[model samples]
Target: MSFLFFTAVGLLAATLGSLVGLGGGIIIVPALIYLGPYFIGKEVSVATAVGTSLAVLIFTAFSSTWSFHKQRKVDFRSGWLYFLTCGPGAMLGSFLTQFVDATTFQLAFGIFMLIMALLLIFKGYLKPVNVRWAIQRTYTDDHGAVHTYGYGALPALAIGLVVGIISGLFGVGGGSLFVPAMMLLFRYPPHVATATSMFVIFLSSIMGTVTHVALGEVDVWMVLGLAPSALVGGWIGARIASSLSSGKLLWVLRITFFLVAVRMIWEGLG
Candidate 1:
């Protein structure tokens, strides 16, 4: 039963994550905390849940990234540059996660989820910042339309550091923030942003996973249960995303985030 539950959580989270560049950490972390005890017969602490989620993320991000790569959407140059700071930041954040208590973690995560939900609500209305300092880059989409976009090195590094820290601390892969930042601040096309975000996540999660493993914060059994399913779902999701717009999908995710946020907050208060 525990295996099945974990697998389901991984599959669902990875599918949605690949579609939107979210990396499925939001769903995995919360599910591990709220539902894990029911199936595993033991409560999973915030640190353990986060660590486990990050471990599971490796498979999801990898499969999704590879799929996106095959579709010629990933911007590897940008990904490597951002990872320079993001990787170290993830290590720092993962180490820091140990200091947070369950209550604080739940409350903080709930608030974070609510904020992410709100961001999604306003994401479509946001305009690109378009900094002149950007190192201009270009990508030709499947339709033969060339999209020009870029970001300043300093700004990109700064965003990577912050996003990486958030990813390690929350086990969320930072895609919610990454996609928006890319689209709004860097003027990246949605598909490119999402693909590149997954690439960066794949790298950062490696650093995060190492930190968590050193701290003995991960549940190896849980990761084994979740990873295979997550891999399959990630591939499926990326394939779907390559050919589809995600308008309705985003709506469903927003609702899910709202419900999960409220429940997490309520639990923390209790």
Candidate 2:
């Protein structure tokens, strides 16, 4: 009976996380730690909870990436860069988990989310509808080579490190931060940013999972049970995102980010 309940939660988390690019940890961690144990007694450990969450995320990331690939939106070049930075960062963050309590990490994450939410809300209100992302013609660089570019690598690297560290601490995929950073800092299209972010998440999550395994934190069965549903959810989200306008997607991102922020604050306070 308890397993059935967990399966249901896994399905829902996959669905929501896929659409939002969150890898379901934002929902999974708290739900498992608080609600799951509450209903099932003290059977599960914190390590199991975190491990299961990552397992589900693995599916979500894989599914989402495939979907994006079909749309030809996955930019391997930029994604590789994100992978290089985010993967190491996640490992570093996960190792530090031993020093700080999850509650403190959650609170700090919550504050970060709140600040992002405010900026999004204000930006939405302040920006004119006429303002849209414009695609400029490719430019030539030194050596007379023509390239289509948006922003520099230094900025992307800096942002990736920040997001990667946050993911390690919170057990999130870090897409929430990655997407916006790509869009705002690099001025990439929304879909492009999202696709790239998912790819980066794939590498970072894999690294984080490795760390969790070394620490004896993973629950293999739980991950297997949750993976299928997460895949389905990712496919659906990718399709929906492909069809929607960039503005609508931004709105969705904003609301979800705000919720994430509130949750973080609550976790920190606890």
Candidate 3:
């Protein structure tokens, strides 16, 4: 029964995550917390549940990233830049959790998820991108040619900081925040932003999981059990996403975010 539940969670999260570029951690973490103890009793601790979820995320992100890469939507340049800050920030955030209680941490995580969901709901109806204080930067790529581009670095930095911290503390991909920040605040195309966000999260999750493992919080068996299901689900989702138009997909995702957000809030409060 526990095996079935874990597998179901992995498949569901991976499918939605691959299409939207989010690992569905908002759903995964809460489900584990509420349902795990019911079946496993003392065997599955809260730390173990969170850690295992992060580990499963590695497979989920990898599968989705492959799909995005095949479509040529992934922006490696932006991904590497974001990773530079998120990696170290995750390591730092992992240590900070020691000072807080478990209930407080979960409550904080739930609230943050709610805020991100609301932002997504509203941002979906806005323009393609917003760049109020854009800055121009020029850099040389691997081919030794210099290219110039404009973006808002200050807001990007701030977004990275907060997302990195939340990701480390909670096992989320931070897409709920990253996608919006890139599209609405930094003025990136929606597809480009989503793809880049996935690439960035792959790095953050690795660092965050490492810290969780070091603290003896990870459940190796649980992660191992979920990987296969998540991979398959991700592949299926990618195929579906490839067939849909951007406008339709955005509307579909908006409705999804609203439904999931309401459920999460209700679950957290109940």
Candidate 4:
């Protein structure tokens, strides 16, 4: 019963995560820590939850990146560029997790999610981060529409560094920060940004997972329960994302994020 329930959680997490290049750990980590005791009669530490989530994200990112690759939406060159700095940052952040306890993790995650929700709410009102640097890139969608986008190399690397640290620290896959920055600051088309984000996440998750494994934090049983659904959900999410505007979904996510954020903060305060 627990395995089945976990499978369902994985499906939901991966579907939502992949659809937006989120890599599913945002959902998985919290669910395992907060809901696990109630539903599965087991409680996991933050480190175990994060480690397990990152392991499962490996499959989700691969599946989404493959789907996006087939659509020709992924920008491999840029993904690699971002990963250059992101890799080491992942290692750095993973080491810092040992200092965090469950309540602290809950409080911090809640604050982060609150910020994410606010970003979604005010994204339209926000201006692009002004920068003088540019590295030109182009993509052609399935319908033959050409789109050009680029981010300053230094700025992107810096952002990727922050994102990698966040990914390892929270096991969130970093799309919460990546996608909006790409679309807003870099002027990437929605599909292109999401596809490319997944590619970067795949690399980042691997780095984080390795660190977690070295720490003996991973839960093999949780990974086994979540991985199959992750594979299915990632592909499905990419397909859906490729076909439609994510406006509605983002709105839903904003509410969900806000609710989760409040839950975490309140519980942490208690």
Where does model 2 exceed 4 Å of error?
Answer: 43-48, 119-149, 245-267
Reference-based TM-score of each model: 0.98, 0.80, 0.82, 0.96
What stretches of model 4 exceed 4 Å from their correct place? Answer: 127-132
Better of 1 and 2 by lDDT: 1
- Candidate 1 lDDT by residue in tens digits, 1-270: 987898899899999999999999999998988887898899998999999999998999999999999999999999998999999999999999999988888888999999999999999999998476548899999989998998889889999999999999999899999999999998999999999999999999999999999999999999999999999989989998999889999999999999999998988898
Please, what are the lDDT tens digits per residue for candidate 3 over residues 1-270? 877877898888877776777776665776677777775454454566667777777788787788878876677876777787777776666656556555665556656766765675677577644344556544443355664434555556667777887777777778877887776666665566777777787788888889888988777877887788888877766666666655565466556555655665565556
Q: Count the backbone clashes (under 3 Å) in each candidate.
A: 0, 1, 0, 0
The lDDT values for all models are 0.93, 0.69, 0.70, 0.88
Candidate 2 is scored at a TM of 0.80
Cα RMSDs, all models: 0.9, 5.8, 4.8, 1.4
Q: State in Å the error of residue 168, model 1.
A: 0.6
Clashing pairs in 1: none
Lowest-lDDT window of 10 residues in candidate 1?
Answer: 129-138
Report residue 81 deviation for candidate 2 (angstroms).
0.8
Q: In model 4, what are the clashing residue pairs, if there are any? A: none
